[model samples]
Target: MINKHVERANRVITVLFYLGSTLLFILLILSGSINHFPINKFYWLSANTSNIPGAPYDISRWTFWGLCAEKNDKNVCSNYLSPAYPISPKDNFDTTTNLPPSFVSNRSTYFYLTRFDFVFFWLGLIFTGVNTILYIFTFCSYSFTKVVWFLQILASVFTISAVCMQTAAVAMAKNAFKNYGDDVSIGPALMGISWAILFLTICLFFMTGGTFIKKGYKHHQNYVEMSKYKEDALKYQQYMNSTKPINTDNASNPTDPYSLPSTYDEGYQQQNAEKQQQQQPVDIIQKSAGVIQQNPKSSVKFFHFKKTKKIPHNDDGSV
Candidate 1:
């Protein structure tokens, strides 16, 4: 029965792989770019804005059609691929830098986690709330393999932990600035940490959703096996009940169809063979009559019946 559950889990895994890939594409875009493409190009307008909060930017204004840098220029859309920008006047960069940064990041984590009280409150409490919710959802359904499900659940934990760490690091950086008074650039450090947090959070979304789907398939397989087992067991029990005391001394006894015997009858005629033996009385009588021999003077005689034919054309009244 678990095999059926396993098979369904297999099919679901295929679908999940595709779905996960699709979702990973979206997630990559949401967190930042994967290569030059935004995975969620379906909603490119919204996802493109995730990192550059309050940058006075709109994804629509940055469309391929509007960005006139044209066939030879990829930089127009390239700027949207990341939160950071290079010194390209022909593109949508807000500020000029030497080159794009190594990894993509959401700019918002920099702002939220840099404050001390915020880190202690959310990292210690709010993220814990989200983690609890995911755990509940995971166990409420287990049709998925324990392994893949574990990966997803594990991903969620790491994401939350990363978020907490990011918050703590940012607050420490800011506190360092408060003590030393403008000695370090807290902004850049906070920005880098926030990117890491974004990656983990995006991973959390994919892993949990995929694992949940796997669980559904496992359940489907289990359900199928259970139904088949029940049907076969019922049939077998009915067969056993059928032969329970066949007083077939009479064949017409009333019984429920459910209790009827289901065995095939190859030797049924053999059972009623006594009736065939009982029918030999006529043959015995004939044989006995033939076997007796008597003298010609015996009272019993053999008689031949005579055949009569009518005379044709007796016209003269002669006999």
Candidate 2:
């Protein structure tokens, strides 16, 4: 049986992880760090040296929207166009160009920021969206847990890849500003927030990945046990088939020494009776012979008496 509380906790954690990642991607995309100067100090420096008439006093505080705002009759500098590439403003000011005047553009910085914004950010966003949908489906359908787990692992891989790309972008952006003036710092609050969120999301993905691995192991163990049981059942069936009952005709054969007849046939009974009858006369003759042997003296005396009687009759006649 599944542990309901553990399942619920996992679901909750996964949902939060996906949701947070999605929001972070949206924020990163909208923050406009890629189009503007990556560092606040550089932006401030560039804004101070610019020739725009009505630009904000503290351009460092301006967001992407404020920086991208169009020119209006009320303010001349309020409409400064966003640059096509990353630039740190120097002495030169050109109002006609789209780029902010008096700034040095760095091609390497532009490449990294562009990739981070267009590639890694979108990839993370797409992965997070798909993960959220899969999580919801998994939560609703408990039978497809294995499928859900596999898909989640894929999603986590994509998310981690995106995060790596973003980290590289941040590193490149920092490297681009390393040789700039003393007061210029590359650390931006938005970047810090983005990094923190990405770190948290990565941690959550690892946790979810571990959970899926454990669950997969358990599923494999159960499958192995079930297979073993099936094999045992098949072996028992074979044993029973091999040891079936002995043939009745073979067991009851009269020639078999182990055979025991339950009933005697008529022929067999008659044969026994005739044998007993033939033995009776031989038994009577043997008994008579034994009696004669035992009384031989008595038989001789009777014969002598008969002879004496006969001689007496003859002598009377002579006298």
Quantify all predictions' global Cα lDDT against the true fold. Answer: 0.40, 0.49
Segments in model 1 whose C-alpha atoms lie over 4 Å from true places: 1-145, 187-190, 193-197, 200-202, 240-318
List, residue by residue over 1-319, the lDDT tens digit for candidate 1: 9977975674455444434433432342232222233321312111122233343333222221111122221223334443322112113344323212311132334333323322332332334233434344444446324444454454445445544554454455344334533322222322343344455445545655665665677678999999999998888778767556543333333464432244435475455445445655765876666666433444356886789998776688776
Superposed model 2: Cα runs more than 4 Å off: 1-4, 32-106, 140-189, 246-319
Considering every candidate listed, which one attains the maximal lDDT? 2
Give the per-residue lDDT of model 2 (tens digit) for 150-189: 5555555655665565455445434433333212233255
User: Worst lDDT window (10 residues) for model 2?
Assistant: 40-49
Candidate 1 colliding pairs: 143-215, 144-214, 144-215
Q: Candidates' TM-scores?
A: 0.31, 0.51
The backbone clash count of each candidate, in order, is 3, 6
C-alpha displacement of 186 in model 2, angstroms?
5.6
